[model samples]
Target: MSRWSGMPRTTRWVVRVIRPFLQVFTRRDWSGADRLPTGGYVLAPNHLSHLDPFLISHFMVDHGIAPRFLAKDTLMTLPVGGRLLRGTEQIPVYRNTEGAAESLQAAVRAVEAGQVVTIYPEGTLTRDPDAWPMSGRTGAVRVALATGRPLVPMAQWGAQEILWPYSRRLRLLPRKTVRIRIGDPVDLSDLEGRPLTEDLLHEATDRLMDTLTTMLAEVRGELPTRPRLDVRTLEPPRTTYKRLEP
Candidate 1:
């Protein structure tokens, strides 16, 4: 059977609904689609705007991969939205609670099941004033390690142009061009089968972030003006999801 034909009803509905709107509203410049795997893999993308998930999902579904997001638990608790998310088999991440560790275990299972699970290593939108990717947490790396799935680094730019970070207002006028570039799976060959130490996770996460930043810069055709913002250095230590933090 065709891949779309095998997709859950909710996932098909999402593709039918969101993909068309994105195609109509924005110009797409997607590359490196050949890098996407047919089997289970961890999708690590840089988070730019709230609209990012839809755009990334569109790219994945168009290429015949059904994306399962590691979304906030609150999104999974919504009345209508929650049902759809559950029906589509997306994973819920319970942050700052006892259930936090459970989400990581769930992601590992999904990968082992041969499903695409997207995790924004940043945990939330970029804190960079220039919209560059910031330092990432280790949750994504941990999942990849446990399941031995390809941790793919995906970079997308221009979504922030349509919807700025933490801003509710959206500018759809005169169509914005969003570019998404996918890179080959991150080389975890050396670290694979090693003990999951704190320093090891951080190293893997840093490599993932560096690949994302480099890919994003290539898409934007310029280098980042400042070094990546490390959330740990903040006086208060800003954290979006405790479950994903290093």
Candidate 2:
């Protein structure tokens, strides 16, 4: 029996359909699957390409935990997307709406239920121009601190070569290398149980991003020269990829 044995029926069906298509164009070079906990924990990964989610999912399934994501509320509203997300037990965040808290609360529930909850701390694909992970949002930090769970920082590379972020072009003629690695859970013991303040949250959030960025730099074989860009403080660049979903 595999971890995917417990995956929602819809997730299994969808993965079955999608895996063959993806495998034809991509190959995996994943490490640290053994480091993944057999129980609930928060998974924070760098967002490089739109297709990276599925690549991450593939690794999780191979290792026996079904990865669940905080999907956009709009995706939940679509007939097909909604059905698929719901069927696969994906959580939706109603951003900027009164239901935003409910979305986060749902994620906490999922983790308590022994599910591996996935969040892109960057809150969007990196706008680093070089694609180093941008400054992360505070959602991942808040959830981990509230639940007192281990936050696993992960880094991935090579997805961008398959389908570049925002480009419609597909270079599937040659199989692309898809690499991923998971590091030890971040130790936030110092900040746990403290009064939740703006500064504390930012400090905790930066730790996650910094650990992830360091791991990412190792994966890329180069150090990042640019600082993490705060998209909130910056103007939106002209890019076709999705960003900042709640």
All candidates' TM-scores? 0.92, 0.93
lDDT score for residue 142 of model 2: 79
Q: RMSD to native for every prediction?
A: 4.4, 3.1
**Superposed model 1: Cα runs more than 4 Å off:** 233-246
**TM-score of candidate 1 versus the correct structure, residues matched by position:** 0.92
Model 2 clash number? 0
Overall local distance difference test of candidate 2: 0.83
By summed lDDT, which 10 consecutive residues of candidate 1 come out lowest?
237-246
- Say which candidate scores most in TM-score: 2
lDDT of 1 by residue, 1-246 (tens): 666886888899888878778889999999999888878889999998889888898888888888789989999889998999999988899976888789999999888988889999998787677888989989999999999989999999989889877666679988999899999999998999999999999999999999998898888889998888986653332334232221
In model 1, the Cα lDDT at residue 134 comes to: 89
Off by over 4 Å in 2: 237-246
lDDT of 2 by residue, 1-246 (tens): 665788898988988898788778788888987787767889999988788778888877777777699998999989887998999988898876899879888988888778889998987667676778888888887788878877899999887777776656667768988889899988899999999898998899899989998998888899988677885675654566444211
In model 2, how large is the Cα lDDT of residue 221? 92
lDDT of 1 at 89: 88
**Candidate lDDT values, in order:** 0.87, 0.83
